[model samples]
Target: MSLTPLNNIGEFALLERLAKLINIYNKDKVIKGIGDDAAVIKPDIDLVQVVTTDMLVENIHFDLSWMPLKHLGYKSIVVNVSDVVAMNAIPAHVTVTLAISNRFTLEAIDELYEGIRLACENYKIDIIGGDMVSSNQGLIISITAMGYINKENLVYRNGAKPNDLICVTGDLGTAYAGLLILQREKKTFMANPYYQPDLQNYEYVIEKQIKPEPRIDIINKLRELNILPTAMIDISDGLSSELHHICRQSNTGCRIYEDHIPIDMMVSNIADEFYISPITMALHGGEDYELLFTIPLNQYDLIKNIDDISVIGHITDANEGMYLINNIGEAIELKAQGWDSFKKEE
Candidate 1:
C-alpha cells in the first residue's frame, strides 16, 4: 500500500476528513464543534467547570518506533481525563491539538485520531475543537479536557484533615512494569532487526503502559455509596509522590503501611523478573492512572468491602511528617521521587 504524505493533502481537506471522525456525545451541551473558531458549550447551571491539559512530545514522552500512534492518542486523553476524575468530576469534552512533521503520512494521522475517537466514545465525551500545525521535530499531542462537578462534590488536594484514611483505587505500579517490559523488548529488537518479541505473557502490563484507562468507575461508585473523599489525586506520578502532594496541600502528615499498598500479581511477577522490589515499583513507579484519595476515618467501614479500593493509611497532624511503615514495623520518611519533567537524567 502506498502511504500518502501529509503534504499531499491540503490543510482544509485534512481538516474535513478529521472532522467527520468525531461524534458529539452530548449535543445538548455542545453548540459548535470542529468548523468553528472556538467550540461553544452550554454551562451546567449548578456545577463548576474543571479544565486540564497535558502534552506528549515525541522522543521525550514517547518514541514512535515502539509506541503506536493510536495508543498514544488514547493515552493522551486518558491522562487528562484522569485529572478531571481526581477532582470528582465527569469529563465531557476535549480539544486535541497536534504538531506534526512532514514525515508522518496522512494515514498515520488517521490512526492517531481513531484512538482519540475511541477514547471519546468510551468516556462519552465530545471532541469539540483543536488545532493542527506543522513541526520540524516530530509529533506532539496536546489535549485539553473539560469536566463538570457540583460545588459540594468537588474534591481537592487541600482537603485532607487529621484522621482521614488514605485510600487508593485499583492496583499500583502496573504501568511502570509494563514500561520496563516494553523497554526490554525494544532493546532486544534494536540489537537484532529480525527478532520478534514474545509478549503474550506481558499483555496486561503492556496494555497498562500503552492504553491506561482512568478510574471513572470508581468515581461513580464513590458517589453511589454517598462517600466523599476529603482529598483526592490520580496516581500518575506514583503513589509516594501523589501522597506527598495531598499531604503538602492539606497541611497534614501521613503514614502508609507498606502491606496495605495494592500491587497486582502480574506486576509482582514482572518485578521479580526484573530483580526489582515490587514495593519499590508500587511506591515510586508512575503512570498508574488510579485514584489516590482520603476519606474521614469513620467512613472506613463504608469502603472496606469495595474490592478495588484499598485503605493504605491515614492522615496525621502536620508535625508528625509523612512516613511509610514497613512490614517490620519500621517507619521511613516518605519522599517525592516520581516523574519530574524538568529533572536532569542521571
Candidate 2:
C-alpha cells in the first residue's frame, strides 16, 4: 500500500503544502505576505486589514496523550487572536477548519466545538466560515483570524525608538511552565500506569497552558489609555525572541530588568521545584500570550502607574545591543532561543 504523505511529513511541512494549495484572495491589495504573525491587507477604506492563520497537528504542537480536545479547540482560536493582537489590531472574525481522523467520534467533535464556541463568545468574534475534512492521521485544526485597524494605527515590529519604555501585559512563563507540568504528568503516568500525576498543586499554571486568554481587553485598554506602542509583538514566542525582533527591526536596543519580569507565585514555586530560575524561564520559555511592546518616553507615566502592565526596561541605540540587567546590576546579552517545534525531543 502506498503510504500517505501527511503521515510522514511534519506540521510545518504540511502547512507549507497547504499554503501552496490555496489561491491568494486579494493578491494586489496584499501589503504583506503569509509569513508573519498576520497578513496586512490594504482595503479600500482608510483602515488596514490584518489576517493570521495557525495550524495545530497532533504530536507536534500538541499531544493527544494528555490534552483534552475541548481545550485544544479553545486554544486554537486564542492563538490566532494573539497574532492579531500582536499587530495592534482587534480580532473580529475567525474561520476554523478541522481535519479529524476516524478515531474521533461525533461527540468528541461537539466537545471540541464547545471550546471553539466558548472562545468565540469570549473574543466576541463570529465564526464566519470554515471546512471539515477527513484525515487518516490524528486531529488537525487550522484557524484563520481577521483583524482591522486604521492605517496610521497599525504597528509592526520595526518601530521601536531609543529611550522608549519597554512594557509587557500580564505575566510571563506560566504557560511554558504549564507545558512542563502537563508533559511531566504524562511522563509520570507513562512510567507507572498507576501514577495519577501530581498536577493538582500546579493547577493555575496548567490551566494557563491548556486554555489561554488572548489580551484583547488589554488592546482596548491601551487605546483607552491613549497609548500607542512604538513596536509590538505577542509573547507566543519567548520574550527574548520577541524583544530581539523589536530591537533588530527597530534598529534599537533594549535593557530588560530581571526583577521586573512578572512571574505568578505558582509558576515561581514550580520553577524552584524544578531547579530553574523563574526569570530565565519567563525570558526564554515561550507561549505566555502576553504583549511585549515599547512606548514613547512621554507615555512612561501612563504605563508605570498601570497595575496590570509593567515597564520592564528601556530601549537604547542599536549600537548598544540588547541586554538583560540582573538584580546584581550586571548586563548580559540576551539570546532569542525559541522553542523548535520540528527538532523537538520527547
Question: Candidate 2 residues 172-243, lDDT tens each?
Answer: 889889988888888889999998888878888888888888888888888999888989999987899889
Error at 271, model 2, angstroms? 1.3
Provide the TM-score for each candidate, comma-separated. Answer: 0.98, 0.86
In model 1, which regions exceed 4 Å deviation?
A: 343-346
* lDDT (Cα, tens digit) per residue for candidate 1, span 30-130: 99888978888997799899999999888878878878999998999999999999999999999988989999999999999899989999999999988
Which candidate has the top score in lDDT?
A: 1
Query: Clashing pairs in model 2?
Result: none
Considering summed lDDT, which 10 consecutive residues are worst modelled in model 2?
A: 14-23
- Report, for every candidate in turn, its global Cα lDDT versus the true structure: 0.91, 0.81
Q: Which segments of model 2 are wrong by more than 4 Å? A: 1-44, 343-346
Give each prediction's root-mean-square deviation over alpha carbons.
1.2, 7.5
